[model samples]
Target: MSDTIAFPYPDYLLGEHQFRGDDVRAFFAPGGLFAEGPIPAKEIYDELNASFNGRGGSRIELIREAYDSVTFAAAYGAYISASTKPDDVVILVGHSIGGEKALLASKATLSAEIDLLATIDPVSRITTGFRKPLQDVSVPESVGYFFNRWQQNYPWPVDYGSDGRIAVQDTASTFDDQLKQNDIRNAAGGTKKRGCTAPDYLKGFCKAFSGTTTTTRTDHGKLSHDDWIEQQLRNIIGEKLEARPTIETNYGRSVTEDDAADQVFRWDVRNHVFSWGEQDTPSSVELQVYREGERIPELSGEVSPSGSVDFNQYGLGEYVFSITAHAFNSVTIKQKVIVQDDDSSGPTITLTGPASRRIADSAPLTFRWDATDESSVREVSITATGRHGERLSPGTWASGGAPVSGSFSFDAQPPGNYVLSRSAVDDDRDWDGSGSIDDSSVTSSRSTSFTIYDDDTAKPTIAFFTSDGSPLLDDSHTESHGIANSVSWSVTDDSGIASVDATIYQDDVVIRSVQVGANDRISLDEFGPGDFRVELRAVDADSDGWVGDASERISSVRLTVTNAAPDVFAGGMYLIDEGDLLNLKAVGDDVDPGDADSLRFDWDLGGDGRFDDAQGARPVITWNDLVAHEIDDNGDFVIRVRATDRLGASSTSQATLTVLNSAPALVSIDATPVADENDTVTATGIYEDESPADTHVVTVFWGDGQKSA
Candidate 1:
């Protein structure tokens, strides 16, 4: 047992205990909405203190949620900063919603180096109002290991009444049934209900758990105190303590080496062995090497006393060597070594090409060169200087092997006198032999010159027109009046026309294209009624290497083939008596602004998929006019209306009209003024009916219980 100590604002001290040897610290937090109380946290803290008594000296802190003054995240951060040391073995455990808080705290205090993090039946419902619901929980890189325990069958209740009391019990079926009932209630009242269940937390936990998770059938409220969970915690803590590293102190003399200390070797040297003196013999020796500023151990192992270490595989660089000697006490020695390249011989190159001469601008020119080096040729670079002294880089190429030889070709350079210079470099100056060859005093150079003449630099011009010889403006709209429209274009270039490409696109997608001469015409018969774009590109006969040469041009025009089907806004279920007049208005409009008033409407009151019953925007229909065979089994008739545009594109809408049967009406009944017992009586009834074609029968009843028809 340990004494209870009070902490600052966010951290409330539940209990503290000190073990014997290892420096370890554990942090625990309880679970609840906002984590305002600390009953379960205190229980787990006592168990941990008792379990860690014989293993090592540890400090345990129970962190309570202090959401009043600060958030749970900030409170955990402050507690970590105030209570933890950099070298202590840290363990963190949280239950329920506190598990989420623990994960956040792990990220906040990454420098504390948490060894383990365990969460029990973790839930993240508090932040659901503003943030997205937790889908998966990711383990922070700062934690060495992670453990998660959860229950699946039974979930804790989350929905509360107006008085802030949970509405349902924590049973599996009870919770589910209550949620279903609440959904029905909410649907009837037109309100939304919020709930968090065990499956919600399990789904996220399963996605995040890299290793096997502990799934229990126990309820969420008792999961933290379950026997299996307690045993798992004990086993993990014991293993962590056993694997903890022991503290070591340096108190012996430094080990001395006999090789040239901190020696620098050229890249040409392959092998180097470092040996220690035999006079101060040590029982055992260990070696570790690392690059500067890097903590990764490049090479590490144990060697015999007075033994030599061979570093033949290491490349040219500066490295630190650490050697440890174990005898009466342990001692470590550090030294540095540098490896570099010192070659100074330059490469030799020779250029061969035609002498300075004039050639057509469309002709291609080629130059060849060969370079040789003592060690190895690394790279070759070339540059061209135009007549105006402007420079153009031909890019550098790596040799890939020893001797370098290649050819450079130029295609239709701008009409000018150009000097092409070439350079080559060997691997001599590449210190460390990393292929870092550059232009220096050891680089070889050569040059050649030529002149290009008569280059055309004028783009082509384009113009468009309609079939009527009227200029067709860009981004223009036109109607498809049941006939194809024709468009013409003219293109001219000074160099000469190579080819013209004309393409028609509907809704940004190409529907038709053709290769035509400089002057050509196209028809819009194949295209449908929609917005379209026309693109025309002209290419000149200038043989330049680059695409879209100086004398190439592209033009585009937007064409809207303005004709669309009318949108019909009609369809409903109606009830009416037989022979009753049903007035149905054709409600619709054309999408095209110019075609709205030109729409025509027709009706199909018989449901025969024909629009012959009537014609107009609004039509009065009658049951007697409907075809008897067209009526469905339910005594209902479907009245359809079609709205068509001037171009014949149309849409149809329908409605269901149920014709109900009408009963006969009675006007009055006539009888004798007085009737004697068992005497004959006569009655007459007058009735009116909407269905005048039906025959009627009348029945007369006397008080003596005898009826005649």
Candidate 2:
């Protein structure tokens, strides 16, 4: 607050007044807008003194007062530490060189409380020091940046345009070691990279900043230093703050509680010291109440110290109250609050106690009051004007919750709210029989509402289960082991207990039946078979799916009888001709003389054909066509052996006849007749079999018949 503290951004003011850079404007517009005329921070306001004004802008230094950076830093440190409260935050901003000071004033840049930051383009040099000035490269978490790029071709106003690089932002400067990203390249290349030089690193800052917000806004600026300032403010704050807080920057720079807007409850900021006691005395905290905007009433004990007191009791809009605590300036501390209200305004209508509630006709109801007031003796007499205002019985309102309880009941209709409240009653409610009543509003213990699920109430849910899988088929049998006695039902929307009667039907016969309660239980240790259709009749509420009762279908496992083979035929069979091989030489022709080949008979001859010795006689034999098998040389089928017993009981023992396909033989050779005088000969052979070979036999009768014959 002493000498002429120059701003580092003097050049910004010069450019802003005459020729501003378009890079500064594209931020909102594409060129600079607001006058960046001599943006100094020592005293918080800009002083524009006209210089040599011409088409080519006058050169000036964008500077600030000495110690500005250190002072801003100190102020920020104070604000964040022992001052700010939970659910409260502020955004600090500055343009050009002022922007530099603003950055310096960041306590969060070090302590880590300030959430967001934005700098159009902060000045920097390769040198590393606080005086060299740059964002703290150490902490680059939530910082946002936007470099005012100069338009390569067009200028603003008359010859107005910004294309070439005017200023460079070295975010990697060591001064910003704690608040900005480290630009290692700054150390490596000593200077900016050629083609890629457009403040792009700062562009990343803008992109990161945009993402943190829900709504987005775009702006443009010009070449002049007079670029948009409000847009920058909005970008920095986003939608986080309830209302934007603007710095009072006319001349001298200083923030006070009075500077805070109405939306802000309190504008309290602590220096580097945290948990500092605001006033000399400890904060007054206890059961103390006072009127809005009035001084806090001192508690019987100590009083919590705050700047002011206010509430909406004066009217309704909005009110803000904040306490200036005495924390002894500890780095971290604790605090508490106590509420004491003289809430008294005789039996004022609090609210209707279920004046329009629905109740089931089957259930009874009782009511109570919840109105409050504290002035004279109060009494509330309410009459039961039922759903349609039908006069209800007086005994229904009789009190009985110990001293006073009320009851209302009916048989047919459903439950509903009784119009029980009115502005005026019998007027003489000061005495409850003998004792004077202090309040009039009567509260009720009655039910609020009710609903009918189906016919009159919620139906019971009957669940059918089986040890078998679903899709009951005809062949499927409820296994002797799979039958179950358990069935379940749920009263999905019922006011009463659910009961069930499960009956199982198997083709009209009652296979099993059981009664189940609330949950349900049954055992199927003995049930089985037949087409079962289980019927579950529930007795709780009405059901939608089943017209009569809920149930499921089931079937029993199959019982099949398989024909077992009799001891008749053998396994190894041979094909034979019917007419050629049939009955064995039946004694006296007992067998038929027709069957021979095409028999295909399996003989149990050697019962187990896979043996070397003759098989035991007692065995089964099979025949594809028994009638076609050879009986013997007679072509008959049966082969019987007559046994003459000692007692003369002559019985014929029969053995199964088997046929074998024998390879055919050459039956005979026929020779053709020869002529009597000349030499001529002819010959032929006969063969019959499934497969026969060629015959080779020759005879020649020379026409000299008498000698060669």
Candidate 3:
């Protein structure tokens, strides 16, 4: 007999069934202080029980807390020592705070051994300052295999603070010392622990034993139910169960090697026959076949003891066949037969396309392919990838008719290096002959590379128009100064218009370049009076590196800008006493050379927009000459200046002049001879002021202390 058993069941059933009366005792412990409904620990326990004890023959327990874990582990150990065989498997899994308790239970197993010990994100309240130390947080030597998973950044709720709110603490690293000592070998034959030391807050446990430390990003709360952790547990348990022995039993009797010797069966692949020896002819025989994961009823049935089942109607690929035979002494024998396809030939394809061509001159590029296969063709797909490895949408084609050849075409594409790929599939893997191909069908792919070059040779055309959309001829345009004179233009090209730049030039010298849009006005107010020219250069949006014709790339209009109004600088405010002479000066300049030397100036002293008070660049006048209507209450007069170019274009400016009033002076006093003190005396004084707008009051004094006016 073989020392170890190899069951032909699926992976999920590895540890679920009992073989040779072996027992799998599994213990699970959850975190948190309360045993709530549907906790992670209970869920994990249910799943593991379903996997390990699906036949209701194994022992599994869910411990709610650390105290209960210790009590249950001791009790279960006693039970194991009394009833379990030497080959039974013991598994212990714990999460969060319960992980520490599980380690303590490992040590409490005494003479019993734990086949597998798994801890996920363990936390210690004593090390985190929540309580006093109670037990050793280390892996026991009694553990045959250890798997540890941990995180050091997720927070856990602790006691409430003084503010009446629950506080959280990062206790993920509370068991670092225990983890460092429990490091084991990884799948690569290297140590799970890193060589360098990390800080306490950043330290974590390594998830080794089964493989290298997992790098999956997980938190403390989610580590208990993490998919990686659950898968690791299932894998370790499955491995342990598969390494044990298998004992064949009949109705209440054990089957000896001799009793099962003649029940052996052999599958004949070439003949599609499943036949067994003739030793079990005293009872019944059963046969079943499964394709993919489901059974095929037409291909499975009961047969005679020495009979052979035929599978010639089935198609290619893998199929699982199960056979059972019962002997006259109630000895039952079961076996599995796997039939796989031996055909190796796949679909053949030959793809063809152009090597290189210009997108502008080349017609629609045609792609053709011929596919041939021994089986019916299922589908054919095509894809195109550009220069930057970006995929262009060409759409996929699928057909059930299984065509052997096909052709397609692509319109003119952008200039770039492209790769065209075609793939064909054949329906050769229909294991049950259902006319539908399985995912394991034969597929063949072929790729061909091509390049599309840009060959745009058309230059952009520029057309100038006035504001009213009328065509404006080149060199026949005249624009007035001091007014907004604008022109519009349109640029177009066969490829596309990239940019249209407008530049202004004065006397063959470059001024400034401006941006222009279609039908948008280009203002000429910024240009001074001169022989100016406006040029527009249009560039096509061709992506090729070739520079096409440049002779007709630019269009220009040479026109004469007429006279510009002279700029006037009127002298600033002036202050003079009444009867003092005031001199005023003004300066003028014209941008047009023809009008520069002939610029004229005029002034308006009254500030009424009429420059008739004075003429010439400089004028002089006395303060007293200013009319009363011209000088304001503050004795201020505003003077204006107007500058005119030779073409009669004029601009005006102004300044203020302040005049001070002069005091009246006494000229002469005339008095009649006053012989007596009571007689009336007459006195008069004459005053002359430079300001004619001022009126004066007079007073006279007599010799006897009485005053008369």
Candidate 4:
């Protein structure tokens, strides 16, 4: 007898379907396929169990109905109790849902030695609502040899059968994509419908047909007893399994076999270069140089028996040197390198500004220059001298590299001659073949001279107006009701105005200033509600405002900005009778709290959209007069209130007032006397009302007892 035993478990509901029919006669009958002749799977298990006198030492256990609770629990408990031994092969063969139970069984019996675990198209427990589908469970780690074969060609719509696929994923196991035995090739030769062919009734019943049905009855039920599955079982029993191989990254070595980091540089003052690859290896090495983190390498080359790569002719920056050494396998190593500057010439500085020997005394002295170096310049400085040829106390300075340019300014210089000078210094570094000058620390300077003169120029005259062609009647002050305002101006200067500028002021504080002319206009878009002033300054060739003497003028009008409208809030509605003195309040408030009282309230009693009744600036109003025309069908009317601020800015609010109908009146009431305790007593009354009500309830009470309504 074979030392190993196969504990076969059939899938869910199909276990009996696959094992109990003539279709599987070849699977049990001896000499047909197994050579041992007819023997049921359970018979094999029972014989093995009885050999040990039912003491529970069985070579095989056939677990059927694995999807059923009772059968599965009993089988699982039995498998767990069977103590497993080393060198003993416990082979498990499960199909469909039975496959799920096999995995569960293995997991439950942690100590059981599973030499081989094979599965057919394992499906989930159909009766258990598919809570844990057989397709989702993975093989337990305790199993040694795992084999999974499934189909993937189930017919459309009726995809209940295997599609030639299984969810069991064991990367180290024997996985085969086997062709399902349900094919027409495996079916008995016949003209009648069989195998992949569907019955005429089935074909006609379906709306559309795509060839023969893949789920032929012969295919689904005959899989477990098929010739191919039997051969797999035989193969497992014969111990014909292939070994799985693994790949390695670093050849499983604790230390590298190459020297890379210590090989690359040759630094020099004027020029430098990096070289590597002196040692020879079994295989050629590949070198790549990058600036680190960057995918694209700046330089790349291969290392042969006698090859060295140069790493110069580049800008000054940090770079990464990477070596990919190849031998029986490959390995990577990285190193960092920094390239320093190498230029030795002093940067040249040039100055340019007012070329005239004399400039307006009121105008500022503006000087500009450019500095450059072959490699890099560190700093630049500027100096000045007075008319008497005395050097100025200090100078202006800037710092940067080649191709740098900037400017410096001096407020209106006193009427005198002055000289402005500038110089640039290169970075301190010595270079080979740079004459006697280290170039680093070398400096270069330049200077220019000019004089300031006083001039006489009068302030410019200005005027203001609205974009709508309305002149400020006061000429110096006006008020606006909206944020959008237009201001137009014109200026005149005796010395010929070079340009005109306007400055806006909020009360006494300056807000913004802009250059303005006859063709230009100003919009106070950002100006909130407030009082402001606009001042104009015109500069001529003498640089009046550009210097100390500013020719300026102010608007003749004070602009009172009341752009925000007052928010109106009418009080709650009320129901009142005619001739009643009703008090109502329609309050108004401007954005600026102080302007709240400066609002006029207007009332539209009938909500006719017209404010015919005006209440000056009073927010509270008393209404005693109501005309019949103001009442609608429901005895209701809307009262709208509009509030207009002193600047004419306005907003509106409204409320509805509903009138009530006359109350109901009782005409008379009568009561009937009761003769016995069980006798009924009645109370009745007559009433009238101008309004309509849903229902009327009446109640009668016994003087010494209860009442009903």
Q: What is the C-alpha lDDT of each candidate?
A: 0.58, 0.31, 0.55, 0.51
Candidate 1: clashing residue pairs, number: 1
Q: Per-residue alpha-carbon lDDT of model 2 for 1-709, expressed as tens digits?
A: 1111112233333122321121111111010223334443332223212111132332222222243445544554454443433333433333333344445554244443444443433332222111123434222332333222222221111221222222223454311212221121111111112222234333432233323321121111211122223222332333343232222211123223343242322111111111112333432322222223333333122333322222222221122222222121111111111222222233433333223345434333345444333433234444456556575565544322211222333333334444544222222232222123212323322223333122354354444434442332334433322224232333233435345566766566777777756454444434433344556565654333324322222212222111111122222222345223223221211111111111122232233332222222222223322322212221223333332212222223344443444455567777666545555545666755432222333334544674332
For residues 144-230, could you state the per-residue lDDT of candidate 3 as single tens digits? 777665544323323211111111122241212123112333221122333222321354533443554442333444444444344
Question: Runs in model 2 with CA error above 4 Å?
Answer: 1-561, 569-709
Q: What is the lDDT of residue 181 in candidate 1?
A: 17
What TM-score should be assigned to candidate 3? Answer: 0.38
TM per prediction: 0.29, 0.24, 0.38, 0.23
TM-score of 2: 0.24
Q: Candidate 4 on 48-79: residue-level lDDT in tens?
A: 34422344322233333323533563466355
Across 189-256, the per-residue lDDT of candidate 1 in tens digits comes to 12222233455466442222335343323344555555434444544565566531111212123333
For all the candidates, what are their Cα RMSDs to the real structure? 31.2, 23.1, 18.2, 33.7
Please state the error at residue 69 of candidate 1 in Å.
20
Question: How far is 190's C-alpha from truth in model 2 (Å)?
Answer: 44
lDDT of 2 at 9: 32
Question: Lowest-lDDT window of 10 residues in candidate 2?
Answer: 22-31
